[model samples]
Target: MKKRAIQILLALSLIFYKSTWFWRVFNHLAKPYLPASREFFQILLLMESGVLFLAVIY
Candidate 1:
C-alpha cells in the first residue's frame, strides 16, 4: 500500500510536468481554434481529476 501510494504520487507529478509545456503551447496556439482549446482544457482537467481521485483512493 505504501509503495502504491508513492507510485501514484510520482505518476501525478510526472503528468503535471509533462502537461505544463504542452499547456503553454496550447494556450498560445489555440486562440485561432477555440474548439480545440476547449478540448485541450477538458483533457487536462480530466487528467487532473484522475490524479486527485488516485490520491484520495490510494
Candidate 2:
C-alpha cells in the first residue's frame, strides 16, 4: 500500500515535470540556468516512462 502510494506520487510528479505550463513556470523562475539539459531530459523521460510502466505492471 505504501509502495503503491509512492508510485502514484512519482508518476504524478513525472507528468507535471513534462507539462508545458510547468516548464514555463520553471523557465520563468530560473532564467539563467536551464531546468534540464538535453541529455538529462532524455534520461529523465526514459526513467519516468520506465517507472510508469513498472507501476502499471505491478
Candidate 3:
C-alpha cells in the first residue's frame, strides 16, 4: 500500500510538471479536430489528481 501511494505521488508530481507546457501543446494540436475533448481532458486530470490525493493522504 505504501509503495502504491508513493507511485501515485510520483505520478502526480510528473503530471503537475508536464501539464503546463506539454498538455497545452497537445491540446492545441487536437483542438481543431476535437474541441469538446478539451473539457474531457481537464476532467480526466481532475479525477486522476483526486485519486492520487486519496492515495497519498490515507
Q: List model 2 lDDT by residue over 1-58, tens digit each.
A: 8987877787777676665565576568766776556457557767876777686658
lDDT of every model, 2 decimals: 0.74, 0.68, 0.78
For model 1 the local lDDT of residue 16 reads 72
- Selected candidate, larger TM-score, 1 vs 2: 1
Candidate 2 vs 3: which has more lDDT: 3
lDDT of 1 at 17: 77
lDDT of 2: 0.68
Please tell me which model should have the higher lDDT, number 1 or number 2: 1
The list of candidate 3 runs beyond 4 A from truth reads 1-15
The digit string of per-residue lDDT tens for model 1 on 1-58 reads: 9987877787777777767866788778887868556786867778786867676665
Per-model TM values vs. the true structure: 0.54, 0.39, 0.59
Highest-scoring model, TM-score: 3
- lDDT sort, best first: 3, 1, 2
Number of clashing pairs per prediction, in order: 0, 0, 0
lDDT at 15, model 3: 69
Candidate 1 global TM-score: 0.54
Model 3 Cα lDDT, one tens digit per residue, 22-44: 68897779977988788888888
